[model samples]
Target: MSAPPSPSSPRPRPRRPGRAHGPGHLIGAYGLLALTALLVLIFSLALPRTFPTLDTVDSILSNQSIPAVLALAAMVPIVTGAFDLSIGYGLGLTHVTVLQLVVHDGWPWPLACLAVIVGGAVVGVLNGVIVVFGRIDSFIATLGTGSMMYAVTGWITDGGRIVPGPQGLPAAFTDLYDSTFLGLPVPAFYVLALAVVLWTVLERLPLGRYLYVVGSNPRAADLVGIPTRRYTVYAFTTSGLIVGFAGVLLAAQQQIGNPSVGLDYLLPAFVGALLGSTAIKPGRPNAIGTVVAVAVLAVGLTGIGQLGADFWTVPLFYGGTLLLAVGLAGYAARRRMRTGAFAARGSPTVPPRSPSSSTQDGGTAGTTP
Candidate 1:
């Protein structure tokens, strides 16, 4: 083997400073922490016995799991410098398809469940192909695809709800959402498990580095022999698969296929993903940050909903959070760019030339202006 790199030889760059560890990062971490604590404290004080109880925590987790899943799903595309707008519509389609397959077609519940999940995966793959091979902009492509999914959902459900069978459905399947694990609901456990696996892969694996490079500079990644298209397609496909799985969870939890329910989930999911970029791994989408973001929304909204807040207020909160998150991400990205610019300027090895040094005659060569 060749000798190891010498100290005098050029070294690879040090790890890039993650946006989450920079100045003012603590502000977000502490802000979210304080907000979470304050919300719990106030709700405890205001509602007394009801708000601080175990049942309340269970309720929040149970209700929040579906949105959390969708948020995590949304985060995948954002990592690849894109967004999956079809998830909300995909949720609607998946649920409706599941209901029709089982309740209407009289298929066995196990087979029906399998079919729906496969359908969701197929949808995801189609999304990836469309975006990658078609050379379409992710936002516009997903928008169109989302619209098509909405139409499919409407067609499937006949624009009405698909109620689950009271007796025909398996108890074990229905209980998927209701069961408890370690005194917490099963859905919460699912979220934790999924987040852990995803975070581990994205943060610790080589694939994540490839994804980051492609997201930051696709052309550069391509020049360096990274398969930019392949990774981009994988990102979209994976995003679709998660969203599809989230749909299964929603069907289990709701016990109905309501076409209208899915769109309501879209805003909150996007909000969680966007807001997540402002924390943990700021300026980049990360699993833990996304989970924390969803938790923040869940806690805040749960408190608000308990306080008898108007129904419209939640959407407004989500929209406002999205705006704030976008602003924060923009600021972080700009700061990173400025940091790099200044670092390049400050380096002693990259010295600036004097005005007199460019002369054709050697008289002024190496002279200081």
Candidate 2:
């Protein structure tokens, strides 16, 4: 018989993260970000004068700011394993209401903005109720609520654009989007600020931990004494709040209410959130990752726009990238299947309800549904 090995003798060690996955790991973590830089390089070289200019940079940052914020807004509910398709519709309703109050009812812009934001939170609560209590799939529930919200948007606008009267929107209100900060557009700062806030809440707070638990595996979370239903509601509510804030920015930027505007943002928002899940922290959605995803998209769109591509190419690009992101996310998940490898996820394991339990550390089946 073969001798049994001594306890002190060497054991087969689990492969360390970088060594286990090698180039695959690095590419999964940073491929999209690297692509962003590469796109800039290629475009700058191809269209030296126009593509590399500060004016182009500023315009891309400014124009893409709202979309980035909207992407962040869309990401909140996704953490709780729920989807809020209503954000675009909610955004439409809130912004039109803002203009209606400011222009027609003569309400102060600040008051109007506040009211819309609160209304958004309420809408989120409604979405949560429908999803959690009503037991409808989140996709269906949010879509239904979103359709209703869109209808309300048209009703308030009376099927026409909501234009300001002679006095126009308070210059201060318009400046919310138009002003500059640190030599860059204020809206860009708004995106950065929102991203930081989300990162803190989702990555560094107990509330975020609970929401992630609920989303990653509601059944497991329930077993572990996490308030799965409550956190799901909170996730929806947070998303609604963010969407409302985005509407305020949209109002300031457009300075005119166009009901059709919200629908256009929905695709890009999802694209960023989904595509972002494949980079910087693949297989899970994150704030900084989402921001980087949006930047990649912004760079690509801007470069293509300058390249004079046909208009239809915009939707084609979004749709294609989304498919690619989904596939890449799946591949990343497969590559990381041995997640129990301590070094792979880069977070310490804790009991499910622990204060620092990152979603990535969920030792449960609480990943994407």
Candidate 3:
């Protein structure tokens, strides 16, 4: 004899949508992953020489590493139903901070890096405060902060590139991005490690569940005694910290501070984050899905480049993908909530889903992403 789910437990860890039988279920669960594989296979067949080589793999991994980190960074506050548009400018500001400290001021590379990363965390705290206390929308708050960061970045570089003398940067600092580990680009590992850590926090920890509750329904979360404000701030802080670290990596890779580089990453990061919410664990912005989304984008971009697509194609793809991901994410979220309610209460008829509904009491799969 088995015990039933107690109604007292508000969250019952709804089964994954893929658990259902049928091709549709399987496709819905893994369409993105399949698309990635299919893209690779098609490209390998079509562009035999350039597309199927280690150099291509290395290039994709190396180039996309920073964007992937930014995507993950964007994904964090999203889990709590908030956005942090400041990341792009913040990334620019932090990396430029590193360049200003290390190259111009001649600070020790390690110390410069430490200061920049810490500064990122501080900025995160500020963003959280602005959103929670200042009562501004996260999008608006982050956008303003991001603009300020861009201004500061321009000030640091005086609207030009920051380049070290012909002596170049310290070898050790350069190695941070250039070195390889376990036959993969080291930066890729950073993305992987960050994703793994986030996955552990959001999928396996109580703190993560609390954040989900906050994202799903703030009023309900408060009624249940969760500190929604504090947790929202925590999410922003974590995002800031990751953005800071990514800035360090960006600095290492470019070895020059270009004031305008950061804005370029803004679109792709959101594309990956929103698109990501539709895979791995559909309807929620999970770390694994974000990673998979990054991979797909990388593959698609690489394939497009190898195929000699026009310059405008990249931005076109990104914009189209962003719109598609947002729609899919919203739809997936609503369906998941409805289906989850059906499964949890064992009610034959699923309830109409509301935009503000929360997930089960103890579960973590709620977010409009």
Off by over 4 Å in 3: 1-23, 345-369
- Per-residue accuracy of model 3 over 68-140 as CA lDDT, tens digit each: 9999999999999999999999989989899999988999999999999999999999999999999999999
Per-residue error (Å), model 2, residue 266: 0.4
Clash pairs of candidate 3?
Answer: 10-361, 11-360, 11-361, 11-362
Candidates in order have lDDT scores of 0.80, 0.87, 0.90
Full ranking by TM-score: 3, 2, 1
Q: Residues 128-178, candidate 2, lDDT per residue (tens digit)? A: 999999999999999999999989999999999999888788999999999
What is the model-wide C-alpha lDDT for candidate 3?
0.90
Q: Which ten residues in a row have the lowest lDDT in candidate 2?
A: 350-359
lDDT of 1 by residue, 88-186 (tens): 999888877777887789877677778777777778778878887899998889989999999989898888888865675567767777789888999
Better of 2 and 3 by lDDT: 3
Worst 10 residues of 1 by lDDT: 352-361
Instruction: Give the Cα RMSD of candidate 1.
Output: 7.3
In model 2, state the lDDT of residue 93.
Answer: 88
Please give each candidate's TM-score.
Answer: 0.85, 0.87, 0.88
* Per-residue error (Å), model 2, residue 24: 2.7
Worst 10 residues of 3 by lDDT: 352-361
Clashes of 2: 3
